[model samples]
Target: MLSRRHFTAALALATGLSVSGLALPALAQTDIKLTLDWRFEGPAAGFLLAQDNGYFADEGLNVTIDVGNGSVEAIPRVATGAYQLGFGDINSLIKFLDEDPSQPVKAVMMVYDKPVFSVVGRRSLGITEDPKSLEGKKLGAPPPDGAFAQWPAFKEVAGIDDSAITLESIGFPVREPMLASGDVDGVFGFAFSVILNLKANGVPEDDIVPLLFADHGLNLYGNAIMVNEAFAEENPEAVKGFLRALAKGFADAVADPGAGAAAVLARNEILDINTETERLEMANEMNIKTPYVVENGFGGIDEARLAASIETLKISMGLQGNVTAADIFDAQFLPPAEERMLP
Candidate 1:
């Protein structure tokens, strides 16, 4: 015969409960602050899904994600420790590392295998489907845009004469509006964003022509998940766990993009679900779910291709620093292929 306290303890153990009749406490979750390359739009659905679906919590991580202005802004924010992780342009990260060579930031996960960089133009503005249609025409581009930052590379690869085209520096908010109003012949931007924004501004889809840089000659990788190198060095397991959760989120988003877009809408009530759904679907099919990604799995890059991209940037952008692909990307944190593969 056991005493009352001993009996209660035996019962608690048998029931997988504590002496106080409560479940055991869970492990402490690691907190992470993350930032995105742009607003809570379609492509941001995966990260949002990871947060809302408890994927991050499953990895014992408490993540707080914030919308960012652009990839250029995101790089410096992560490097400066303003954010622990971010989604940003890999080319932009390359340039940053070249300039400083000591910035403790590197891309750990490749998101956009096929970049969205493009030059969008209105057909009525004497811009046709040809890459050279903009000769002697004004091209509007936001000064800090990731697509515009790679213009020189695109120009070199496409064999376009720089002297024949006039460059017009435009703010991001006005890029599409100005093109719709015939204020500029063409604008440089992400293909998905420019096409949708043009349509939203009343420009018919048929009237808009997108000259995708990737289709032409630039084989550059686009945005990626960047981590502060210092942070990664100190917390390797946490970084791996983050990527695992992120891969799961992406896999889920690829299966049913509408669910991913809904995840974004849950966070931002001002967004239009129909439009964002379309955008998310477009991004999924065109960028995220490419045949290469489908074949090789997500979050890993081909070294030879990445090296070629670095060489292209060095020549086209007049980069003086001796930077290599190794300096800009670190694949150690990527989840295993079996885990990242899509269903």
Candidate 2:
């Protein structure tokens, strides 16, 4: 468990480095294991690209990247010390903190700054233009994760009746097919997963309409690097080294989106249901949207963004009753990367 004072001290130290020109001394080699948000896909490609390209080793670290079952599972696994770090959404992290403030899970890095979950419907529904058009239509949703919980806001922002849209728990898989075949008027899909699958099945982009949560008001940072609080406390230096190398990997992904897509395909043994072109496009989109690459440079966190997410989770997902941003994340492990000459 991390003390509140300890986190504040770390945040102060982390704030000392300028985003544009921060760097660190070369670190001694160490072994670190990371868990992913899900199985190999364009979304999880950056880690694969970094590992395959020797980015981690170059940073004087040897990392093992494990596939994850889901973001919900990913957070607790890291917090409980099953793994050093895991990829997750801010909502999941907040929920974990709510369950146990003293638990070790803390988000040290932001991966996706923009929320990726979206609602898809046919243009013929007239609901495509305005969110309210779906008044009497059924809206397909998954469980109580970020996507499901945020649907009401997704409808509210569009002036649609919150109750008008029926909540159908479609689970994670089979959501894309459910939307395409008209089994459901609309379903929840991420920019990378749902859109990719639809386009692959020859669903013309114009024929489909997406109501992304980011476009609405659900602006929680998604897909972050979470580490066990205990591990981060005991091995702050190791955590710092991990971020330094990860930033490099992210920069590489942004610089060469095509290579990044290839790395994902190779890692998974095949591309996702989407076409190669769509996969590449999704990769670049997700890369730029990642807060690790956007808000405060790669692998950094924006306190304001985090604060907004904390409120959203509490109001929308019924997360821990009174969790604060400080309770869910610690930025101290992130040193200024500009000064460090990463490998």
Most accurate candidate by lDDT: 1
Q: Per-residue error at 245 for model 1, in Å?
A: 0.6
lDDT of 2 by residue, 1-343 (tens): 7698667655655655332344533435677888886777766656777787887787677798888765667877787788998887667677767877878688887767666767777775554756666677877777634565466556544466666557688867777777777778877656666676776666778878877777766676777788887888788877887877676666666666667667777766666434543565575565444435543465566787788767666665666576787777777877675622222
lDDT of 2 at 125: 55
Q: Per-residue lDDT for 59-153 in model 1, tens only?
A: 88999999887777899999998899999999988888989898899999999999998899988898887788878899998877899999999
Worst 10-residue lDDT window, candidate 2: 17-26
Off by over 4 Å in 2: 1-29, 152-159, 272-277, 286-295, 319-321, 337-343
- Point out where model 1 deviates above 4 Å: 1-26
Cα misplacement distance, residue 25 of candidate 1 (Å): 7.0
By summed lDDT, which 10 consecutive residues of candidate 1 come out lowest? 20-29
